[model samples]
Target: MDDRIDVASLGWPAGLVGELDHRRLKAPSVKLRSARAGEHGDVTYCVDLRIRHPNADEYLTSTELHSVEHFLLEGFQRLLPEHFVSVGLMGCQTGFYLGFVNEGRSEVLCACLVRILEEMQAATVVPYANIEQCGNWRNHSLDDAQRVAREILARREHWLDAA
Candidate 1:
């Protein structure tokens, strides 16, 4: 397993998140998973993110939104522009929402999600100081955070191609 992941092959043809910030739109409160009965099925390829913030309300903060906004502009907008549907921060918890362009595309999306999780598992830690400032899931080191983000980006390319 390569410890350092290289995302130079997304075919994005540009730097991630650099030039695409203004085109993002927020899709508030999407019902992705269901705690209720009879609300599950056919969930395949998807980018289901489970955000873990200390204070759920802090998700409303510009910092948190900026993090997600950067992701949307960087990865989703460039890779899966046609399949992108909605992005909502989950209202019930520190989680978020993701709806694709088609239910049929769930299989590939699930694979990308799994790849992201795997890369995150392999990541080292970001220092505490930066974490305190960034307020991500933890005060992980920059390397760790960038690793995870790169995983997301790389898998995004994989998902786009597979879909």
Candidate 2:
């Protein structure tokens, strides 16, 4: 392994760069892709959720990121059952990625996330926080997740920023 490698220099999966033009999608909503999405030719769509502001901690604390992961994983499954692939946090904690099957849906994925963020804010407990249910259960915080969700809900138009 190249022990000297810098994580900061490798922000996103290089495979993702070919498809998403994240720089121009700052409007209130971001439409799903017209072209196929996936691992080059694998047909899975990926949505990279980026934190816009400078305060990374405010947007994604460790506890909050864990809670948000559970929420998005479940929420997207319920909303887009057929298309939702998976969700995961970035190592830098500045964002997360949502993956799904590319069905070429006309709806905006980012707009749909706004609704989900509202639901996350209203949740009283963090799901899958028990030791038996999670790897680092004690490291979760519903409060932090809700706070971050509230900020995201308030913004309503923050798009994925380019790495």
Candidate 3:
């Protein structure tokens, strides 16, 4: 049998906390895993949050991705119109990429993400999980996403700048 990991069973994208400074928790020669922070002259500071589901077999379904995309993109744009640029799932169904446009913006973005996760955990009905409003409405899983979010929150301190 092939011994290579399925990539999802690694149960990672968490536990990156470093003495409360939130350093990049790497898997040691497996992959490049870390949140990126940088800025341009005028554009907003880009804060990227990378994650993967604890369960590799439990990759995000289309509806799940769509629902999350809708929730984050709309919510952030509405809440942080000046900072929020874009929010979407990675093609690999591992995590999300969030963009912002201001100095010292990662804190706000990270805070918002935590808030969203908290809300997502308590939320039973996804905001746009409907056939009329969603393309793959039937394939979403609020439970799974919330589970991942909760795990992320528990280890939320891992999201910080090391460089």
TM-score to native of every candidate shown: 0.35, 0.67, 0.62
Per-residue lDDT tens digits for candidate 1, residues 15-89, read 321122212312221112311112243222223354333343433333444444334433454456666566565
lDDT of 3: 0.53
Q: Model 1 Cα displacement at 42 (Å)?
A: 15
- How far residue 104's Cα lies from its native spot in candidate 2, in Å, is 5.1
Model 2: CA > 4 A from native: 1-42, 52-59, 104-106, 158-163
- Candidate 1 displacement at residue 163 in angstroms: 26
Tell me which residue pairs clash in candidate 3. 8-56, 44-101, 44-102, 45-102
Tell me the tens digit of each residue's lDDT in model 3 across 16-75.
211222233221111213222343344433334545433345355665566677667666
**Clashes per prediction?**
12, 2, 4
Top TM-score prediction, candidate number:
2
- By TM-score, rank the candidates, best first: 2, 3, 1
Q: Kindly indicate the candidate among 1 and 3 with the higher lDDT.
A: 3
Clashing pairs in 2: 37-44, 38-44
Among all windows of ten consecutive residues in candidate 1, which has the lowest summed lDDT? 29-38
lDDT assessment of candidate 2: 0.59
What is the Cα root-mean-square deviation between model 1 and the actual structure? 16.3
